[model samples]
Target chain A: MKIIVLVKYVPDIEAGYQFNSARRLDRGGDGLLNQLDEYPLEQARRLAEQFGAEVVALTLGPDEAEEAVRRALQMGADSGVHVCDAAVEGSDALATALILAAAIRRLGGADLILCGAGSADATTSLIPVQLAARLQIPALTGAASLTVQDGAVEIRRDLDAWSLQLAAPLPALVSVNDKTGEPAYPSAKAVMLARKKPVESLDLADIGVDPAAVGAGGAKVEVASITPAPARAGGQILDSESDDVVAAFVALLQANALI
Target chain B: MSDILTLLDDPAREAERLAFAGAIGRPVGVRLAGGPELAARPGTVAAALATLAVERDAAAVLLPQGLFGAEVAALLALRLGAAAITDVVAIDPDLTATKPIMAGTAFSRARVTGGLAIFTVQPGLEAPPLAEPAEVVELAPPAAAAGEDRVAVLGLTPRAASGGRPDLLSAEIIVSAGRGTGGDLGPVEQLADALGAAVGASRAAVDAGWVDPSLQVGQTGKTVSPRLYVAAGISGAIQHQAGMRGAGLIVAVNEDPEAPIFEIADLGIVGDLGEVLPAAAAAVRAL
Candidate 1:
């Protein structure tokens, strides 16, 4: 069996980020594999270790995104693929999915395709569905737990009001959340070995995508404006160390009818 | 310009959704009352909605914000060859949709450069309800086309609605904890119980395995807009603030004097949560 895990390289949000003049997130900064994608990557690695599935880590981003594939290799992926092209810089969810689906097809398809629930940078969570639409496959998203057997994949999804168990036939896509497990840290030997792993790089043309059909020119959504939200004013802060503090707090809640 | 089609999965939110859609264009509400089996098949649902949109010449589609909203919206967008937006908080007459970005520190106002607009509107906007009920037509999930990929519902476990605490998404009041809890949510749950509020946790607490991932309140978790939010032991990172900033009233308790949560909180107390949360819960109970 073969599994393809899609990964993304996102700016370290904790490192502080800024929007560029085009209202796009400035990707020029220290970056790392999106923490969310690690969950799916870990799942792929587990499948490779236990079921002898061939794990291929794939990414679509700038040159910096190659790091995501390298990290996946250290985590036990058998190979890596990075689709980097200048024309794909400003692609939105739809355009991104078009490119990724083409890349997956170029790689001869897979029995299973996995991705994180959402990218930390975009937070749209649209890619899994978009890719499924473009590729004509079943999409199972936000899976808390996942299992594969008998040419079918099943997952438990925790929604706001219900927990649903869903199943789909093989050649499907699944996006998992953080509940999967903590990703194993790469050992020094694994990290050194990852450098020797072959990573195939491709561009828009290589993926059979027209340059005019992607990037800013082909983006369906246009940013009109971006502004910082008005700062909320700090209200009264009381010293709970003082006597009658609990009473004072309770009175406030009572006044608001919140208690 | 054409009519905006609003997909109503929950009738209780009809007025707000219609009002929001009405601002963009003429509102044509389509009520979708699919059962669990149909709801599990987003592709079939999207196909049906796409057909409806075309038959009605819809310039845009509005869907309820929920678990199925984004996926169905994406599929519908793909079918219609339109642009899709989710978690929309505002829309201008010109159809510019505004949503939170960078974890709610900023807002991104965007418009479809071409074709149709598909959106999942966040609930609880300040828009006034329609004075009269709009016409709502029931929509049924169409049969899946031949050779189309479909998902099967193997099983389902409905969360107890009334007998348990309110779900985090719809809770009017929320009591959230953070790293300061020291991996203990006991006091947090107590306060939540006394106030009938849902319990939430910061990413730090959730990462530390102190709380369920469903109970996490942050950028990567669930966004909530409650009537009142009481945050305990949380320093209020930018991501955490994103989830609760829409709340009407916010109260924070932290030992640190300069915790960022106090910046946006309407009321704050500086003290150890170990002492403060239990005391607050006890006081509320006595009241």
Candidate 2:
């Protein structure tokens, strides 16, 4: 079996980011792979190890995003592919999917493609389904646990009220949530070995990607602005002597029917 | 502007309203369902459809992605000769464009190949759009009498454990405590009280039994994007940060200056949370 794990490089959420004069994130320094993406990477690695399958980590971003692919390799991916090009920048969800679909096709396709339910930065959570649609495959999302056997993939999905177990044929897309398991940390030995592994860099031209299908022109929604959210007003703490504070708190709760 | 109409089931009205308003303009009609005679009478869905057909003359219909709404939207789209787009987050300008992909990690631009594209937006991804006063024209109850759908209301029993402030998803301010709270929830509550913030706990603190599991925030728990988030004694973990990283302002109070929480915090205080929180609360009150 062959599996492809889609990964993304995101700004470290814990990093205090300041927008440069261009109103974009300052990315000259290092940023880590999106924390959510790790779950899928680990799940892919474990599945590959269990089935003796080949696992490939694929990422689409700027050239600097190679760090994310390297990290995936260090974590046990058999090889890595970087779909790097300036044309990929500022691409909205649609453009990104088109590029990824093109790359997946170029890679000779796979028996399965796994992705995190959502990325930390955008949290759009729309990639996997769109990719499945483009590839004409069944896509299951919000999967808490997944297993492969007898040429079919069984998955348990977390719904609002109950868990649903469904099975799909091979050559399907599955978006795994972090509930699957905690992502494993790479060992020192794996990190050292990752350097020797091959990471193929593919440009938009190499993948036969049309420039118009990516970047700003392909984006549907325009970000009017990115401003700070409104500030929250502090509340008064009720003291033993202050009936007003106590009354206000109780009234607020009652009004919302939370009492 | 192209108008978008959203249908509502009164029982899920709040969520439906938020979902609709978050996606398009003010919803045109509000339909009530699950009455005592509903089983014997015409379904409210028919009435809602009629209202959309006659009054709103809705160009398109939208619903959230789920079992009931998905079925309804698909049926309505087919009936109206509208193109169907499922699991969409945002509609582009001209109303003819749609961008729906996987939970939103990637997007694909698609135009309504046919007229009146019906789409469903995923909940929790897009914020509800602002409300505007629209002249609501209520229709008389459907005369067909209720028993069309056999789905019965066996008994409506609300869940307990509902007293924990606003959900982290909708809360504007969150006061999250970590291991440094010393298993004493008093000070954390006091701080939450001062700021009118919802109480949240890190997975580590929750695992330590310092807080309830329901209050845990992280990749494994709830994702929150509050306007202001205050972390006390929590050394930011990548998993935890994934949940609250979208917060507008982050303030960290930790005894260790090297704590990872400080790295993301806009304001950092290297001191005991027990001391710092009380002082900060008092200062906020004074202001």
Candidate 3:
């Protein structure tokens, strides 16, 4: 059995970001495998270990994207596939999903496909279901915990108000939440083993995707403009615990008819 | 401006979506998927929406933003060859969209390249205009697009819940605790009781297991716009700010003066929350 994990190298979300002429995130900036992607990677590794299944890590990016696949190998993937192409740059979630689904098809197929709830960069959370659509497979998204049994996967999907336990057959996709588990840190020995993990690089031509069909031209949504979020104005400070503080708070509440 | 169509399967959500339409000053029509009386699944309901969007010739369809909204919207857009955007905070008169990304660090104004825009509205939008009587349509979803075969909902189970969780979306007053609560929600709950407010937790507190995950307030948890919000011991991460930034009034209580939560807070109290919170709750009760 084999599982495919989707990995993305995104701008370091913890640091400030740089934008390009297209107003999209600059891929040239410093990046790492998206922090959210770690959840799905870790969960897929666990599933692979238990069932003795093979796990493949797939990513689409520029030259640095290879680092993302390398990270997965250190974490315990069997091999890696990098869908690197110049035209793949600046693709929206829709176009990106199309490229990824095509790559997955080129890999033959997958018993299970796993990804994060959303990427730290885009935060769109659109590709999981979109990839499932293009693959003609079922998708159980926002899964807090997932277990496979009898060729079907059951997931605890957490929502704002309630949680749903959903089940989908094999050849399905599930986007795991960050709560899946703490990622297994790569040991020095494991890091050494990752060097021989067979990292294959493919381009649009290799995957049979039309170069003209992606990138800026094929993106569904266009950024008309991007402006930094307005800085929050300084508000009144109440450091001293005077009688005035409590009275003021209650007064404001009453004024708003909140009390 | 486009004629608005809102989707409703749960009658309870109709008002919220209608309020969104009213907030944007648009005359609206409603597509009741599976009728007002029927309890509809997400898949069938999604198909119903797809059918209704074309039947009514809608310019834009407003969906009540929830966990399932974007997936359904995207699928429907793909089927109809339209456009979809989630977490649409506002729509201009010219029909441009303003949405936040990267946990609210940046806001992008976008316009769908294609026609027939589908948008998901956030909770607690402000200043609803007068709502006109809306026409309702019922749809029988196409057999192939119903998507029932793709995934099945086995059941719903509670996640180590302590009690009946508060509905933070509609709560008028919310008292949220952060990691600084020292892993105990007692003082926060006590303050919430004093103010008749809902109990909320930051992602830090939720991840720490000090409060119920359902009580989490953040980008990933829930977005709320209450009349009054009190943040106790939260660090004010960009993620948490995305949820409560819409509140009418924000008060922050933390030991650190440099906590980011104080930046947007209307009132800042820099001190020990353990002492300040109980004393303030006692004061509120006295008032």
Considering every candidate listed, which one attains the maximal TM-score?
A: 1
Each prediction's TM-score versus the true structure: 0.91, 0.63, 0.89
Could you tell which candidate, 2 or 3, scores higher by DockQ? 3
Cα error, residue A156 of model 3, in Å, equals: 1.6
DockQ in order: 0.60, 0.05, 0.53
lDDT for each residue of candidate 2 in B56-95, tens digit (9 for 90 to 100): 5555666654434443443344334344555554565445
Task: Report lDDT per candidate.
Answer: 0.83, 0.64, 0.77
What's every prediction's RMSD, in angstroms? 2.8, 9.7, 3.3
Stretches of model 3 off by over 4 angstroms after superposition: A160-162, A233-259, B22-43, B140-147, B158-166, B246-249, B256-266
For model 3, how does the per-residue alpha-carbon lDDT over B1-287 read when each residue is reduced to its tens digit?
45677766456566666666665545464554332112113444556676666776767877766557777776766667666778878887556888877667678888777777877777666546454655555555434343357577677654565354456777888999998998877888888888878999898888887877778888667778788899999989877897888777898888888999999988888877888788779988987
Clashes of each: 0, 28, 0
lDDT for position B188 in model 2 = 68
Q: Compose the digit string of candidate 2's lDDT tens values, residues A72-188.
A: 999889999999887776665556777898999999999989988666555555466557656766665666788888887777654333345656678887888766778789999
Worst 10 residues of 3 chain B by lDDT: B33-42
- For candidate 1, the per-residue lDDT at A220 reads 89
* TM-score computed on alpha carbons, candidate 1: 0.91
